[model samples]
Target: MSRLLGLLGGTFDPVHNGHLRAALDVCEAGQLDQLRLLPCHIPPHRQTPRVDAATRLQLLQAAIHGEEPRLVVDDRELRRDAVSYTVDTLHSLHLDFPAARLCLLLGTDTFNGLPSWHRWRELGELAHLVVMQRPDFSATDDPVLARWMRERRTEDWTDLRAEPFGRVLFQPVAQLGISASLVRQRLAAGRSARYLVPEPVWQQIQQQQLYAAP
Candidate 1:
């Protein structure tokens, strides 16, 4: 059987419980052999992360420490020193793991904005897209995306194992209303993000005074 590898990429300005939970949910639900938390150096669609790549990486490591053995970190995007494009990252992963079936996990919001990404159309060619959606989530209204979804969407997990790429799976995960922005906002306002982020991550944030008011 081919190994199933999942990739969850983000700035992870400060790794939080929501991110960890979602990753673990997808990892178990999808039966991934390993799920890497990829922290991008430069996000193409969002503002630059407040913390540097090294600091963000450290926080991610802290958040995942002694957690799931399968939850690992991949820092290829940070080393690249260029705009972090999903297509480029997928290509690199394909090279490194030629036989592994790659699953690119995404939130519904990010999946909705797929049309705007660089070389977006080619995403399905490189890896399967696992969209983490709410149970009540409805189909997208965009005609182009709707059509694309119809072409690639699959409900069965077996379809992902059957092919190395080009399938889309919508998996419902527990929605924690936490966002990295929200965490940062609370910290900057001298508010506590105790349960929003892991204890170790919160400790590191305090130690470094990251995202605190200037």
Candidate 2:
């Protein structure tokens, strides 16, 4: 069978539980052949992490726990400079693994911000964009179908060409509604971030005293 690889990239500040579960969902729920645990060197919009890149990578490696036999941690971003960009990362991956089909995974909040991403249009040509499901689909729901629908207006049978260029696809998996920032806030306040992230990650956050300042 042909294989498709999913790339989940983030700072993974402490490689919390929710991030791991979401990636796992992408694999099992999306029937992904494999997943590459990509930890970015520098998150563009976010402030510099309290913990450095290596530390974050270490946390990611520890959190995998082998549930995803096909999952692997990719560290090219770490080897690169500051402020990592997804387009560049994907381009490099394309060069390194030319035959593999690359798909990016993100939540609704991130997906809604794609239009502002670096070289966003190139993404449509490079690989596919997979948006994880949120709550109900409101009419104002950013409508990922536009990537195809707009093109269809110039052609016939719009619905027939639903996945043109495989630009955008949505998969709504069950996940506890939580945020990483919230987890950090709870930890800093001496509150338990129970079941929000993996046990080891929470331990690391506490032991490392991460997110305690500011």
Candidate 3:
């Protein structure tokens, strides 16, 4: 049986429930042996995170510390000091885990903007894409993306064990209507972010007074 390694990368400004839940869901859904929650140093697609990479990495460590094997935090992108590109991370992972099936997990929103990513097409060559489909998204609506999806779509993840890369699998997972931006807003407003983020992360936020108005 080929080991399946999953990578979920993001700018975890303050690791929240949604991020953790999505990581857990993808691990179980994809039967991934280890799913690394990667923290980006400089996000290529989005604005630079308000919090520093070290702080965000600390929050990620607190959020996933007790949970090992199933979930772990990868700081390669954070340590690189360059714009975090998914393709670069995938390429590195491919070299590290040559025998295992490498899968990159992304939400539907991310998948929809796949073309905008740096070297997006090369991503599939390095790792299988496990796109988490949302109830409201329609990737088929885009002519270019629709054609791309058509050529690489696969119905079974078992096929991943046979081949190392170039498969696109769309799997439906529980969509929690949570966002890190919302949590930050709540924290900035001095409101309760209790349920929105994990306790350890919440504690870290309070301890460090993160996202508080200056």
Candidate 4:
């Protein structure tokens, strides 16, 4: 049987609890064999990460240390000296794990903005999209996205595992009101970010004086 692999890509400027919680929720709920946290070198839709790639990777490693064995870090995007497009990443992952079913995790906001991504139309060919539904966010308003969702959406996890790609699943995950930007702001303002991020990540930030006000 093919393994069910989950991919969660982000800048991960400081790898916080919200990310971990959502990942854990999806891993358990979807019965994923493994979930990789991919840190991008350059995010296409958002501003550059506040921390450098190496530092961000370090924080990510620190955050997941000894937490969940399945939640491992993949630095392929950071290693590549080019734009971190999800399409390219998926292609590479397909090459690496041909038999594994790929599930690309996304938040509702990211799913809604999918039309604007590089080679967005080709995404379904590479991996299944698992949109993590949050209580505060609603379904996509874009007609194109809505139609796409209607056409490919699957209510069952088995449907995703049965195929290597070309399916969409909206999963309700634990909603934590935490953002990396909020963590950075607190650190920059000399406020504590103890509970916002993993303890090791918070310690690393303090030790390195990362995101401190200029």
Candidate 5:
């Protein structure tokens, strides 16, 4: 079987517990050899983060420090000056490890809004989409996406293991109602974001005095 490399990209403004849990859960579920947590330099879909890219990268480094074997911090997107598009990142990964199977991890919310993304259709050709199911939305709610899901969805993990790319997989993960925005809100309001983020990450944010003001 070909090796599986998972990519989980986000702004990772503070790298919270929800992000860690989902990454760990998906690594086990997908049987990935290593999962790279990519922090986006610029997000086209949302407002620019209050925290700078450097700080976010530092926080990501801190969050993934002891998670070496299963998780690693990927700074490719941060190094790229242009807007961080998922397809572009996948294409780069495909080039770097052409023989290994590349899986792009995404939440259900992001998957549902795929049409709005830059060159979204080409994403499947570059890497397999592993959409983690969320409670608020379903693929069937969007007819176009539902049809695409029907055509490309894979039921067998072995099939993913055999191929290098081009398939979609829906996974059920623990529903944690935590988000980066919420974590920022709590911190900015001078409340405890202690359990929301990892210890090292929390310490870094506290020491740097980040997100103390809205």
Candidate 6:
């Protein structure tokens, strides 16, 4: 039985519960064999984080600790460059796991802005994309994104049970309001971010006193 793999890319400045929820939902709902968390070195569109690459990876490892054996943490992007590109990562993963079906998991907001990414339209042929609903976004809000989907002849996609990546699939997950930035903000304000991230990660941050004034 060939396994289906989900690639979730993000800066993961401080990997939080929401991210975990997203990955878990996508994996289980999509009938994926595994879900790999890809933490990018450079997010490109967003402001850079105060934490470095290694620490970010540490946090991710700590966050997904009790995840099922199917969930994996892939470090290729963090080791790749100061400026990361998704298409490049996708190509590399394709080569590494030729038999596994690959699908990209992303939030609805990012999915709408996919065109702004480097060579976004061509991505469809390479990987199956899962566009999930976000906690703060409404499906009826973006006419342009809707229009773009129309242009691609990708609309009328009423099938949530379809396999992603032509062999995989796109499925909806429970919307979570948490974000790494939000966790950082809470920590910075000296608030309780407990349960926001894994305890091991929180302990590591405390031991190292991360997010403190630089």
> CA lDDT, every prediction?
0.91, 0.70, 0.85, 0.92, 0.87, 0.74
Per-residue lDDT for 1-214 in model 6, tens only? 4566778989888887788887888776767778899988887889887899899998888778777577788999888865788888888888999776677887877876776898776576667777666556655346755665554433223232243353213356776678887888887877767787778888888888887643
Q: What lDDT would candidate 1 get against the real structure?
A: 0.91
Candidate 4 similarity to native, TM-score: 0.97
**Local lDDT at 31 for model 5:** 86
Q: Against the correct fold, how does model 3 do in TM-score?
A: 0.96
lDDT of 3 by residue, 56-173 (tens): 9888898888889689888889879788888888878777788888888888888888888888889888888898877887765678888988888998878876788889999877
The 10-residue segment with the lowest total lDDT in model 3: 133-142
Candidate 6 to truth, TM = 0.85
Model 2 Cα lDDT, one tens digit per residue, 1-214:
3357788888777677667777777777657778898888878878877678888887787688666567789999999986788888888988887776777887777766676678776776766666666666432244653554244222211221333334456666667667777777787787887577777776776687776745
Clashes (N, CA, C under 3 Å) per candidate = 0, 2, 0, 0, 0, 5
Q: What tens digits encode model 5's per-residue C-alpha lDDT throughout 112-134? A: 88888999879888888898776
- Each prediction's TM-score versus the true structure: 0.97, 0.83, 0.96, 0.97, 0.96, 0.85
Tens digit of per-residue lDDT, candidate 4, span 115-184: 9999998999989999999978788889998898798989999998887788999899998899989988
Error of 3 at 23 (Å): 1.5
What local lDDT score does residue 181 receive in model 4, on the 0 to 100 scale?
90
lDDT for predicted candidate 5 compared with the true structure:
0.87
Candidate 6's displacement at residue 24, Å, is 0.7
What is the lDDT ranking, best to worst? 4, 1, 5, 3, 6, 2
| Model 2, C-alpha of 198: deviation from truth (Å) | 1.1
